[model samples]
Target: MTKEIWLNLPVKDVEASKAFFTAIGFTPKPDQSAPGERACFQAGKSIIMLFPDATLKQFNGGLGVNDTSTTSQMMISFDAETKEEIDELADKVKKAGGNVFSEPSEVQGWMYGFAFADLDGHRWNGLYMDFSKMK
Candidate 1:
């Protein structure tokens, strides 16, 4: 079984990223954060690591940094256990100063969800999956 997971993302400003996530209900994991360069947040059992772009570049080898404004290679999604939870989270995203690209609605019949872009323009989605409706 997979024990744990970590999603690492590059941010222009670590402090701002931390504030954004915190405002949107993500809890900061101080033990996991690396002082000024990295900010860590908890997303369920996963750890979300927000590192300064330059610091992230050092670990990227040659893949290069992602230009989230021009292109999106990743979209972080949060799983919701209830439809209401999805709606609540969607609202929180906007309240935290994030942009909602897709408002809460039925998606593919089985998913009740919404999509938003964080302060760093990182795309994220919150969805409630109805397993019985999936075909």
Candidate 2:
């Protein structure tokens, strides 16, 4: 069984990427820092790696960067403890120079969520589930 997992993503700027993740409550793993290659951040059990675009190109055999304006491969989701927390995070992301894609909204009468994009245009969704309202 796998004990842990890490998600690797490519970005144009490492410092900006780090700042964005920090604002979203991810902590950097100091041991993983290196020169001109990769940076790692941890959010609870999830690990997100930000690699430079050139490194990512080399790693994937020279694949071109995705056109984020037209398509997104995935949106990272974080679970919030409450609806207020979700809203608070949305505000923080914006204040940290990110963009909020959605205001908090109810879903299926049970969950509330919002969406934001990081400095590098990576989209993230934060959700709060009301389990007590589940049928």
Candidate 3:
């Protein structure tokens, strides 16, 4: 009965993180109840919810989140319609104050992408895959 999925992430600053995502073209989902404490964005068919560090810890039952600076938690991938889109996103991420860990490059002659870390160090990558190049 699962109709949709949402990703809840911990952020050091909701406002800054929201701005970063917005700069990279993620559509914001307005929620007046939480104000500066939370932010939500629509990434394709999924929803990404960002909460202040302490707020997310409370929601996680005090388990806390990873220290992204030293830990590799996960890589969230975004599908691009073309290779140019991937390149464009990488540039946007860098301009938005994100760390572009991996420069845009071809992968196996079929996929092209680049990885970046958000201001809070959450890893993400935008990829464009050409199925026709696959055997």
- Candidate 1 per-residue C-alpha lDDT over 36-91 given as tens digits, one digit per residue, 9 for 90 to 100: 78999989999899988888888888567878889998898889889998888888
**Ranking, TM-score, top scorer first:** 3, 1, 2
Model 3 stretches with alpha carbons more than 4 Å out: none
Residue 71 shift from truth in candidate 2, angstroms: 1.2
* Residue 63 local lDDT, model 1: 62
Candidate 3 lDDT trough over 10 residues, lowest sum: 29-38
Q: What is every candidate's alpha-carbon RMSD to the true fold?
A: 1.4, 1.5, 1.2
Which lDDT tens digits does candidate 2 get at residues 1-135? 876788888888887788777876779887896645678888778888899988888888889877677779899887988999988888889889988988889988999999987887888999999998977
Better of 2 and 3 by lDDT: 3
Off by over 4 Å in 1: none
lDDT of each: 0.89, 0.84, 0.90
